[model samples]
Target: MTNLLRWTTPDLALTFVLDDGPVRLIAVREASQPRGGEPDPSQPLVEVAAVGHGHSSNRHAGTVLGRQLRYARHDETETTLRIVQEELTTGLRVTSVFEARAGVRAWTEASIIGPGSLELTNLSSLVIGLASIDAELYSAANSWMAENRWSKRVLRDVLADIVRDPHHHVANSRHAVTGTNSWSTGETLPVGVLVDRSTPYALGWQIEHNGPWHYEFGENRRGGYLLLSGPTDHEHQWSVEITAGKPFTTVPVSLVVGTDVDSVFAALTRQRRAIRTRRPIDDRMPVVFNDFMNTLRGDPTTEKLLPLIDAAAEVGADYFCVDAGWYAEGDWWNTVGAWEPSTTRFPNGLAEVINRIHQHRMVPGIWLEPEVIGVRSPIADELPDDAFLTRHGKRVAENGRYLLDLRSPAARKHLDTTVDRLVDEFGIGFFKFDNNTMTGPGTDKGGTSLGHGLLEHNRALLSWLDAIQERHPDLLIENCASGAMRMDYAMLSRLHLQSTSDQEHPLLYAPISAAAPAAVLPEQAGNWAYPITGTTREEFTFALVNGIPGRLYLSGHLNRMTPAELDLVRSALTAHRAVLDDLHTLVPAWPLGLPMWTDDWIALALNGVDVSYLTLWHRAPGPSTITLPIPRSKIAPHFPTDLGDWTYAWNDDALVINANTPEPAARVLRLE
Candidate 1:
């Protein structure tokens, strides 16, 4: 009889069978499927391949395939399975750990117990084999402005062709998606979903590494396999020597099985919340007014900011932030270290501005790019070379800024002093932590590989953030990497808010704000609303509607606007706050499907328990109307009720609406 280990949640179940030789995944199904089906014995539970000094052990050659030395299980609401396997010849011990919550998270640790060292050429964090060859792969292709562009293709389309004459076995074809360097989501998001075309089963997984990582799918002899991993030698020049009594742990990866795409996303959402770090200020979800877009444009002075702060508070903004250029004089981008208050920008001291912001009853915030030291700053020479990231005995500079190595004590001390002084002296409550530049591959400071150095620095950066938050528990941090370039869950899971985009054009930014919920939570998404002076009423409404569905990051020169324009801004903020409670529990759904790069009409609906909120935009010059996915019950304008009139009707199974206005128009509606 096959000894099987089982773990189940309310909607998902996973089973592993140990058949005396190796442990293999027997079943992974949703609630609709029956339990205890026949187990597939072709593939093992964990696949680990390594090579050392001309000796190589491929994934299929791991000791787990020979015989399991011992096994144990731990139960505490969630289930954890620990299996230990030993290679008798090499004296290598491999421990596989599987944690089951709403989904399954697995990883492996390879330890050298003998006198010889081992070099790992290839290592996978997790691998799961499925019984389906007819599957379609789905992944998001992301970039700076065009983020989360998902595409799908069949497995056979990219598979290698082979003759199936029943005479010889065909080699498996591998298809991989990889991201290099420190920007985790610089190229593609660390997410993928595989759906069985012929059945209702789908498998999804995400690599939770902040540095370089890769995931691939390949055909095996039985069916197919999915492999997820972190950095490797060929890609990021990563490798580590395992000495005696030392063990190496790979990156963590999460896996979930569901009946369809929606179910897969639901499982992922639960898993994301399960792993997120707890914070106190997450429940507030305040509206922020930033003086960046179309206002000061990073050139804030005493004269330009005091009026804006008063105007922001008058319009019901909870937090008022003064963006970049507050700490420097003229041409200050390359001379930005030290973070001292500019003597020229503020005649008295920055304290006057902070006091004025507090008098207006708004939280005072400032912009900080903490990871880089300016090349022309005097502080650059004061710090030792080890304080910055080095390549080959020289500091690595990008765009006239040197990257700070958080692993160094001197670097951490400098940042802690700067942040603590700002909070204590200025009474600051919010910080916009911006990373404007990217250090290419990695650093080589401590006789380590560039990839390994970058991995350490990334982890160290998170640790520094934890320290800062612990010190100032009331402070909120906005994660901005030139506006969502490094916008991955690794940062979002810890940071308080995510700046969705920096696109200047209001009409072009509509689709970006509409599609942001797929990558970030609604309450954490910070979408900008920058309505300039010369835009039409429709265009002004278009810009203001972009920020209503998410956290309304208010911008533009409200102090210089007309009374009518100011009323529109206030109306939008009022409507946003009215529905803020529902947004906490709402899940995003694309009613008209996900927006295209240049869709004429774009829509995003946040489905809640009692009511749903929808934001619609019309960008084309011709007449157009969108039919939503849900049945029309009652539709009312939730924001800027004074806009030009529109028309709507309840179709059979969808809600149809016509903007009836000219180009570049939008509306925010409440559906009940």
Candidate 2:
């Protein structure tokens, strides 16, 4: 007899069945829907394989629909469920855990209970099979300065060729979207949505891993299946040897089902907050002013920073960060391992500049690239070979820097000392941890495969960060990999903020900022607002508008701006502070729809309970008015209310805002 177990949220439900075979996902639907009434049942909840010492021992496993197994035991909590099952012949126990809330978080653990060791290969965190035959897929293709570029495609486009009439023995081909190395989000986001065309149902999920991950969609006898996994042997040379007493667990993956994309995204937003290790600073989304963007450009001197610090504090900025090159002399990229105060840049020491920032009631912060040791730095020779990532006994160097293996005690100690010294010596309350280089596949040390070693190292890095947070409970950290190259939830779940982009052009950055909420939470999205001198008032408004809906990361030469430009900056800051408290409970939506790389106009709305904030930018010549999706309501200009030329009109079901000016203009509005 098949025993059925269930987990559900107010809007979603997931059902699993345990029988004399492997555990299988029976149904995933809205709370009011029936169980998997579909006919197909070959898909399993999780997939695993055991590669033994001999060829005869290899077993290819899929859905537990046909295989024979024995149910061991089960455990349950209000929000979580765990079930254990043992293979009939191999004695391998597979434990699957499911957590329910706004979404379902699930993962699989493999353990060998018998005497012999087992080689595990091709393990997936979760495999969700959809019975809907004509489903459309939605996923984002991300890259540097071009993050969160989403596209929608029909399942038939990718799986149609493999689904034949009635061959019975036809082979199934898989269409995979995979990413490699520590920059898990460098190529594509670890998220996807499968929506049925005929119905208002969709399944969305995010693979929560910071390192290499793989997700694929293929046609199965039971409609189609989606596989979410970590590093695999074929992609990352990854495999693990599980002993009798040890257990291996894959990274977590989240699943949510709803009637449409908006509802699914809303559930995901709640899931993101639920899984995060909350901190006090998250509640207070402070405005940060960094000297790197269009300002000092990382060449901060005591003389150059004093006026900027005053300007930043005058504008009500809460934190001031001294970006890169703060500790370097001239050519500092390759000699950046030893983070020390430069005698030339700071004649009175970096402490003097930081103290000035403190005098203005702003917290002092600095940038640190903690994962790499420069090739020319003395620390490269000071640390042992084991401290650095090695491939075949040779240190792996990329972009003139050697990647540090956080798994090494020596490397962890070094980073700990550096972070501690900065916090203790300078009263630093924030640190921007940036990674600029990628370490190919992974390391070959520690008696593990290259991909396995990288996985362990990534896990160790997270553990080290947890220790740091434990010591400094109030400290805030911003996760940046050359501006969001590693913007997966695995890192954002622990970090306080996410740097949205590195694109310097204010016009080009508008779309990136508008689309950021699709991948990151609104309060955590760090959008840069750098208004340079000599630009028009519209241009200044364009720059400031980018930061209004999210964390306003102020930049530009504010100290050199005229009184009018300065007032514009202060006005944006005032508006941002007014909405900071309300932003905590708001979820994001696209009214004019998701921005394209070359869209003429972009729109983003932070939808709150009774009120909402909307930001619109016109980048190219187009229609003077763009209709919004929200209903007709009272609308007011939120920022730069003094712009007398701009106007808006709300019809029955649409709010049309007209940008009286030409292209490269923006406005922030409050809708009720």
Give the whole-model CA lDDT for all candidates, comma-separated.
0.78, 0.82
Global fold similarity of model 2 (TM-score): 0.96
Q: Write the per-residue lDDT of candidate 1 for residues 292-353, one digit (tens) a residue.
A: 98789889999999999989998889999989999988888788889999989999889889
Candidate 2 per-residue lDDT over residues 587-669, each given as its tens digit: 88888766788888798888888888888888875447778778876678898775456677767788777777865688888
Clash count for candidate 2 is 2
RMSD to true structure for each model, in Å: 3.0, 2.4
TM-scores for every candidate against the unseen true structure: 0.92, 0.96
Q: Report clash pairs, candidate 1.
A: none
